[model samples]
Target: MAHDDSVLIESGLQVLKRYASRGETLSYDDLHRELGDPFKGADVAVQVGKLCDDITVQHSKATGLNLMISVLVRDSETGLPGEGFFQLAARLGRLPSTGDADAKRAFVLEQEHRVFMVFRPVKADTSGFAPNH
Candidate 1:
């Protein structure tokens, strides 16, 4: 049976959100595992690609922050095949000023695939959340 696009997208979002909330990055293998067995050989990668685009678009509409989720394919450091990892891009409220250098640095340092909501500009605020990227 063919899986509906909306269902697949929702499932993907839930998975992303779950990991994000925990301040963790999701690898392609991790995502596939969450998807369970393929139904009639459905392409999980294709579905995930679509889901990523949808999430980026949906989150971009929010105020204060322009959030984006990206799927990155990189060569494995172990010399294995290329692997994919998810990352979150966040741009705070407005353009950075001279005094905002520290904040921008902190933001970039904290910009991983983990949930953005839990992230704080100050390092002290991130004491509880350990990033797995």
Candidate 2:
């Protein structure tokens, strides 16, 4: 049987897909506006956080203007498709750990890719690194 989509999955992916299509980032408030009727309940913020947790979306810091959402593709070498929203951490130079269940999953996936790269042997070029004599 086909499983029902999680509430977060449906609404979150909808929001993300819209932004992804636009190819532009949006702040949280603007995102709420775009969401229209779906943005409701006291749990909205919590839901957004969850969305970030799931790696389906991301949230930014309170910029006094608008909280931005990250739709940037992670490193291509990582072999991950371009998706997932994550707020960037200023210090770490990457998305700050959400420290939630979702964050853990993202972390694990990242590490897994790292390990994969480490094990994969580099392809040799016919021309040596030093150059031909």
Candidate 1 deviant stretches above 4 angstroms: 1-4, 37-47, 61-65, 70-114, 118-133
Q: Model 2: per-residue lDDT, tens digit, 34-131?
A: 55635478866444444443433222222221222333223234333222333333233455646465664465455434433433456678675776
Q: Please give the RMSD to the true structure for each candidate, in Å.
A: 10.7, 14.2
> Per-residue alpha-carbon lDDT of model 1 for 58-106, expressed as tens digits?
5445333454433221122422111122222323233233344455444
Q: TM-score for every candidate vs. truth?
A: 0.45, 0.33
RMSD of 2: 14.2
Total colliding residue pairs, candidate 1: 0
Judge candidate 2 against the unseen true structure and give its global Cα lDDT, from 0 to 1. Answer: 0.42
> Residue 128 deviation, candidate 2, in Å?
41
Clashing pairs in 2: 58-85
